[model samples]
Target chain A: SQQGEEDPQALSIQEGENATMNCSYKTSINNLQWYRQNSGRGLVHLILIRSNEREKHSGRLRVTLDTSKKSSSLLITASRAADTASYFCATDHDYKLSFGAGTTVTVRA
Target chain B: GAGVSQSPSNKVTEKGKDVELRCDPISGHTALYWYRQSLGQGLEFLIYFQGNSAPDKSGLPSDRFSAERTGGSVSTLTIQRTQQEDSAVYLCASSLEASSYNEQFFGPGTRLTVL
Candidate 1:
């Protein structure tokens, strides 16, 4: 069974706009990681935020975790057409990682 | 230096036929995982391997599904008597270690279609 659920199952926005996706999990986790998958392709690791940390940034990606709320969010600043992909949030517990349903975002040029 | 790789990018087989999918993890990677993603659905964990230790098969849906890892480097997932419900994208991933902090690198996935 999956432990995480992402909101905004699908989103579309013009290029250069920021896209935000939210994920909520049911159990405690050691860390939460995000991944991007283009249609018919493999997933690419985006960023990982440990439980002890609250926020992390890499390039145009930003991830925020609120363990108290059992939720996390991913923000893509200044999105581009190439950023269009399905974003998934995964929670690592013990040695197993559970992924969410994922949010599909489309950045139109 | 290469990423994880899976064989047979696409497979089309009869419903009663058995199929096997292979995965070759990156060199020196100690952890490997298998997952299935149905059309427009989330990934479902199938199995995991850590080094030479016994694999974690708790996520496998049924006895029809089995997996083996040899030399702790290559793994194979076998589905006996395939069914229409088993059609999905089989994904393989590998990480440097079993720790939660390690990022899992994924392969392009094998798309299985049961006719």
Candidate 2:
């Protein structure tokens, strides 16, 4: 079974708007990581938040993790056309990453 | 420095044929992993190798799916007697160590089409 599940299979917003996606995992995790995939190719690492950490930010991306609820959210502020892609949340347990179905975000210009 | 690299960016094979996918992890990386992603789906863990330890094959779907890592640097995933349901993108990743906090670097992946 998959360890994580992303909510809202797809999302679309204006270029200047913000995009948010949530992920829920079934098991305890050491950390949660967000990844971006373009053209269904390789996945690019976006942000990682440790279980001990509640929030993290990098550039225009913000990640929040709530171990109590076993959920995480990724927010992309000031979205751009380039931000159009599929976002996935992975839960790190032991040494492997279990991923969810993912959320596809489209930023319309 | 080079990131993880995978071979045969794309592959198409007939059902029942055997296919091999290769992956080259970043230098000095001690942990390597394999994953499969179906269209519109998230990645599924396949295997994991850390240093000289035995690989964890818990995620392999069946006997037809196997993988090996040589000298702890390069890895290969093999699928024997491929089935149409086996079609998916094969992804490789590597991290500095097997530590839970370590982030992994991914390769472009090899899209395998089993017909």
lDDT by residue (tens digit), candidate 1, A13-102: 999999999999999998999999999568898998999999999999999999999999999999999998999999988767788989
Worst 10 residues of 2 chain A by lDDT: A1-10
lDDT by residue (tens digit), candidate 2, B1-115: 9999999999999999999999999999999999999865558999999999999999999999999998889999999999998999999999999987899889999999999
- The best candidate by DockQ is 2
Per-residue lDDT of model 1, residues B1-115, tens digit only: 7899999899999999999999999999999999888865578778899888888898898999999998888999999999999999999999998886788889999999999
Per-candidate TM equals: 0.97, 0.97
lDDT of 2 by residue, A1-109 (tens): 5788898899999999999999999999989999999999899999888889999999999999999999999999999999999999999999789999899999999
Taking the candidates in order, what DockQ does each have? 0.74, 0.76
CA displacement after TM-score superposition, residue A106 of candidate 2 (Å): 0.6
- Mark the regions of model 2 whose C-alpha exceeds 4 Å error after superposition: none
- lDDT (C-alpha) at residue B70 in model 2: 89
